[model samples]
Target: MPFFVYGTLRPGEHNHDRFVRGRDVRAQPAFLHGGALYDGPGHPFATDGDGTVRGALLTAAPAEYPGLLVALDRLETYLGPGDPRNLYERVVRPVEVPGSGTVRAWVYLAAPAVTRTLRANGPRIPGGDWLSHRPPRTDRLLPPPGPRTP
Candidate 1:
């Protein structure tokens, strides 16, 4: 599955090699529309917008998700179903990749408030390039989205 990653977790950034693994992994510059980029304490998050936000389109083997999850957060540190960690929350958001049809790939988006707060305090990593190198922590973490229920 292809995962959209932005922040300090993108390839060749401060945190890429620790998370991205496997011979089947591939990455390319991609984007997501309808969002605004905001800086955080140690990362950045896109809020509601109409223009495309810069990021990466990660093509990985079906088995690579698990490894990526581990690098995202810590097991048993938050919850189950995936791993229990406080790195990112998984969701299926619409992404607009140039020359490619709209596709819904799994993306780990940072919480808006936390990401924004981080940005106000210090310098941001700038797009997905800086994201590839930061390690995730247990601070104010989240999980993948679940089905909407009444």
Candidate 2:
């Protein structure tokens, strides 16, 4: 089984540098057929519909699966693949990458509803799992606090 990774698991992204160290990442243009990626509570997941996501296509040794699972154990919350309750689950699915023909990759997904609801509420604040990895858009980088006045 090919384990596809999207979201923070991506190279140079937060999770990659932190846990995985992003050693063996292969670049690919992957697309999740029917779901959009969202920054959820602490990770990403798929919704009930169709959409696309992109990231790395890391090839793991057959024996590596067990170690990989253990590595992801804490990060993915052990929800048992494809379950809303789990942080991330393994799914054997197809994605469309521009250069690569219809390819199979493993991706981490979270509940879209959860993300949609969060989105509707307001922008996700930078804190906890969210405060790392992603680079800030110039507009988003807040100016330093103003000097105190008497």
lDDT of each: 0.59, 0.55
Task: Point out the worst 10-residue segment of candidate 2 by lDDT.
Answer: 122-131
Residue-pair clashes per candidate: 20, 12
lDDT of 1 by residue, 1-150 (tens): 577777655675555655674446888778777655655556666544544567888877777767765655442122433443434456678776778867787666544444455456634443433444355554326665788779
- Choose the strongest candidate by lDDT: 1
Task: Report the lDDT tens digits of candidate 2 across residue range 1-150.
Answer: 455566666655666666665334345545566655555544555442444455556665666566665776567675674466764455667766667677776555543445457556634323212324345534336776799779
Candidate 2 residues lying further than 4 Å off, grouped into runs, are: 22-25, 81-85, 111-150
Cα lDDT for residue 1, candidate 1: 56
Model 1 spans > 4 angstroms off: 21-23, 73-87, 112-150
